[model samples]
Target chain A: MGNEYKVQVNHLTKKFGNLLVLDDISFHVKENEFLCIVGPTGCGKTTFLNSLSKLYDITAGEILINGMPVDLKKHNVAYIFQEYSNMPWLTIRQNVEFGLRIKHRPEAEIREQTDYFLDMVGLTKFQDYYPDQLSASMLQRAAIARAFAVKPELLLMDEPYGQLDIELRFRLEDELIRLWREVGTTVIFITHNIEEAVYLSNRILVLTNKPTKIKEEIHNDLPRPRNIADPAFVELRRKVTDLIKWW
Target chain B: MNQNKNGTKDNKKYILMSICSVLVFLFIWELVTDVLGIFKSTMLPSPVKVFGTFIDKFTNTKPDGATIQVHTLASLKVALSGYLIGVGIGVPLGIAMAWFRKVDCFVTPLFDLLRPVPGIAWLPVLIVFFGIGLLSKAMVIFLSAFIACVINSYSGIKNTRMVHLWVGQTFGATRSQLLFKVAIPTALPMIFTGLKVALGASWNALIAAELLASTKGLGFMINQARGIYRPDIILVGMIAVGITGAILGYLIELLQKLVMKRGWRQ
Candidate 1:
């Protein structure tokens, strides 16, 4: 609980050729904190997340994890892509075990970890099923299960539920929050949905359109077992929505 | 519902009718040739005689007056050997070119320069260097099939999604691991597509090689029939080539399905 300041970003700037994607962005993610970033479409939220994970080189900035530089070779980071990220050739169980296998964990440990996550995500019955055989919600669940099973120090997701419908999205969102709570891993989630951002995040960071800079930061002080119908939840959604809508 | 079912049944009936129509045309061909007696037997043998010759040759141990099994086995050997060599070289080269920008730039112009010349056009040069033997025939096939495979394999790897790469990178995969596990697996469907096209090209090249220079093979058999003025034998050879090519292609399709069944859904 005390390690909540696990990730710190200072003056991060990223550019692609002549175009600037992120401008002077700075943020801190407390350990075990669910930090959600919301911006208008193409506001460079994804790029910012990528920069934090070192998927993209920052034009100017520094990111620290646990009081040290974020070295990809040393620290473990997992990204849950927006769409079906599981390889079609691998089954549900195998997909969940892919990262562990790549990291060359022992066979016994891999099997036990895979089985545990498959059950955690309610996909134990479909362990042998391929990505194409699963429904969209189920595939997302499998992907999330895969990312979490790696036990990453920091989990980065790029609109993981952006493609899903309202009902499935919310259900998966619930599962995600549950997983985050149980694992207590630092999370940085990116989305354009104001409600989803407010619903899942303990803190929200809003950014302006491309050549983007942070527009606002809001702390969601809502208690656990958060009710979407609560006034505070509605107010937070409204504030985030207004920031993007007016921009 | 009944009308839709009936419509599908009628579609099948239509196809059957179309086939019968072709048979009827052949029947008229036989009748006209018989009644008119317009051509000599040497010029255009009757369909009955050609078919009879085909059956006698195919079924009997010594009907065609030549050792067809020897010819067939020779041709198969040339085709399979050339095809295997081509795939072995082309698959890796293609993947390398696509994966590395420097390699692609270096090799693109060379391949482009060599690709336009058909395999047959190289026959004279090959004959001069290797003579009219198995090596020359295999060379023709290798040249024809290699280009097709390289292009397909290159495109397959080139088009791999960055998301998959990022997925691997974020998971702490080394450069080699990412290339082999993510890029190669993702590119497999296209690689098979290339192999299928290359195989078809290999068959085309075989005939071209045999036509130019060969001691024994189906291509040589067909060329020999042409020189001896035996139209029936020519027809048999033609049928043999067509049937064998189709059968080989079918087998390749089955093999592709079997080897790739795990990832077939994508």
Candidate 2:
């Protein structure tokens, strides 16, 4: 059972000075699972994700990728920040190739991966455009392509589409789902939007306010191409929404 | 297309206005000195007299021991040498200081102590060590430019966004790779700004050192004019300095634009 899980977080705890942000949170993500985490505003969701990526040093407990302890040098991880993390100086093609280059992949593999991801995100035509030249949605697409090109074992996204309009958000969400399906990479997406959690994840983890703990983890068996207006989708969204309401 | 046409038209008008303003200023100076005779010729040379002196100084070397071209070249050589040395040393030292904690701890205290002392204040000590030769003068200019380069480069590296660093780390970048590929590229605009400031400072320091100590150079030519009470010669030296400084600054700006064509502005 332990080996079956890709990510096993055991009693993860984090604090800033005297203020406790995350308190004894425990969870496991199956291999290639699409897990979405939703919580109330200021519920330390970002802190939790940051801890998993070792961006924030946890005060206690451990995080494991596979059966071994999580080590950035040993494991492959990719993060998509709320703000666009595309290197402004690199063109779209170069940006997509950045991680592969860092990892010292074979030249042919780097080009093939970069090309595949760029095409997947529909950015092949804009490969020469710098991040500044692209529109907001296009910039996010470039970021996505860059992340996917790395073929990371764990993909952590922190409200990556939080700033986009609803229409663009849905479009990118669909693209994300398609990419996830094809790539089969384990994904842990953190968002404040309940509908987003319902629309994307195989399972949703609802977290509590302040000293955040796992309120519940609801398994989502909703079929592919989920409709927001579907009764099951609405029921699941409402359940997650009810669990996250703090006030 | 219409907006670009309007922009070009406005740009032309501005150039015309700039030329007219310079002419008007020269006219006023000529009125005060020659036509009105409000001031003696020795006190303020007329624009025409200054113009004549500019041409005469190029051909005549009696007043300064060298032609204007030779003096200009000497000044430029000394200034550029000091400027390049300062950039070569200061930029790397600054980046190292920002990137390594041990380097920062070792260098910061000494740097802070010396930072407030003006570059010209080192003149007496430098002259004593190196004597009143080109070396001493170049050292002063080097110190002046070095301070600007060190400060800007350090800040530039220190101010790279944490998010950028995190992204680099996630991709399995080594410490050295992060510094070279992420921090340095991110710091380029500030590095260029430092280069510009250092350039201007180098020029100022060069002129000051030449005026005080050198036997040849633009500063020496101006100082010689002062000794001989040739206001026209002094006016010519001042104009030359102004034009050369503007041209150097413009060249740096052009280089910056050429390198940053891919929207580093973002």
Candidate 3:
């Protein structure tokens, strides 16, 4: 059971100057688990996620992926941020191929994976368009397609749809679920939206306010094609919101 | 279809207006010099006299000892050599300065010290070191273009989006990969801006050096005409300089368009 953990964070601590942000937080994400980390706004959720993604150096503690310290050089980790991070100079197709090209994957493999993901995200028709030429939803879709194209061992998403409208957000959330199920990679999705966490995750990690710690880890064994309007969904979301004491 | 026809009509109208404006300006200039004779010919030669001198100098090399074409070729050689060399070195140095802290620290003090000094101010020192030859005058232009290219390229790389860098880092790209794949391409528009500024500076610096010390070039031709008191030749030389500068600027703009036309923006 212990060996099955895909990601292990042990006493993750962070401090910006004298003010502590993440105080000795520890958690373990299981293999192929869609773990949603929901926290109150301004509760250092991004800081925690950034640390986990190795974008920021944690002051203390360690992040382990497949039972080793996080090393981007050795591990395949992909990240989708709150903002559109696609290189504006590259077309949507080139953006999707960026990581694969960087890793020097075989040409045929790169083309195959790129086409599959771009088609999967419904961006096949817009492949030649630049980022500025695309709408917000398409841009985010490009980011998702780019992340999944690498077939990452671990995928990190940080409020990737925070800027989208509710309709677009739901559409992307569903696509993310489909990708997660198909790829079966370990997913760590960070968001402040409780309903979003409930709607997408296999398990939800509820975080406390500043100097954040894991308030609770709830198992979300909700069946497929889960309805957000369903009573069970609303009740689970309420339970997470109640834990954070934030409406 | 109507909108397209109207747009074409508007463009033609603008072109016609531009031609008319130049004609009116030349008419006014000719009137002040030739028709009224209010100002002496030496001070401001008539447009007719200037145009005659322009054509005559193309064939005749009496005053400057070199035809207009020869002077122009010489000037192009100096300007282009200094300009290209500066871009080749300055662009890479600037990018390195921005991406590497050690390089930035080592080079910034030298850059800051030289930044305030005008490129023309280096002419006397360069003449002393290399004499009033192609090397010396080109060195003056090199300094001017170098500063511009470095400033722009450095600022361009520095302006790379942090989010883009993170994307590269997360995807397991190395430091050099982040630079080439992410930072440099992202910084391209600004780097082009630097190239444009560098071209202008190099041209201006070359002219100043030629006016003060060169034995050839449009600037030297103007200086030689000034010595012989032939305002016609001077005016022609000035016109040549203006036309050449505009043409060079247009060429740079064309290059910019060609390089950046990867459908970067609408």
Residue B239's lDDT within candidate 2 is: 89
Residue A63 shift from truth in candidate 3, angstroms: 1.1
Best by lDDT: 3
Per-residue alpha-carbon lDDT of candidate 2 for residues B115-226, written as tens digits (9 for 90 to 100): 8987878988999999888899889889988988999999999988888888888777889989988899888888889999999999988888888889899999999999
- What are the TM-scores, per candidate, against the unseen true structure? 0.91, 0.96, 0.98
Any runs in candidate 1 off by more than 4 Å, and if so which?
A1-4, A245-247, B1-29, B32-39, B55-66
- Sorted into a CAPRI-style docking class, model 1 comes out as medium
Candidate with maximal TM-score: 3
Q: Please, what is the whole-model Cα lDDT of each candidate in the order they appear?
A: 0.86, 0.91, 0.92
Worst-scoring 10-residue span by lDDT in model 1 chain B: B57-66
Superposed on all Cα atoms, the candidates' RMSDs to the truth, in angstroms, are: 3.1, 1.6, 1.3
DockQ of candidate 3, scored on C-alphas against the true complex (2 decimals): 0.75
Q: Write the per-residue lDDT of candidate 3 for residues A84-121, one digit (tens) a residue.
A: 89888899999999999988899999999999999999
For model 2, residues A7-120, the per-residue Cα lDDT tens digits are 999999999999999999999999999999999888998899999999889999999999888887778999898887888888989988988888889999999999899999
Q: Fraction of native contacts in model 3?
A: 0.76
DockQ scores for all the models shown?
A: 0.61, 0.67, 0.75
* TM-score of candidate 1 to 2 decimals: 0.91
Model 2: native contacts recovered, as a fraction: 0.59
Better of 1 and 3 by lDDT: 3
Q: Highest DockQ: which candidate?
A: 3
Q: Which ten-residue region of model 1 chain A has the weakest summed lDDT?
A: A1-10
| Tens digits of lDDT, candidate 1, B1-266 | 99999999999999999999989977876766655667666776767877787776655434334566666778889998999999999999999999988999999889989989987788899999999999988998998789888998998888778887888888889988888988888888889998989888998899879977988788887788788888777777777788888988999899888888665456
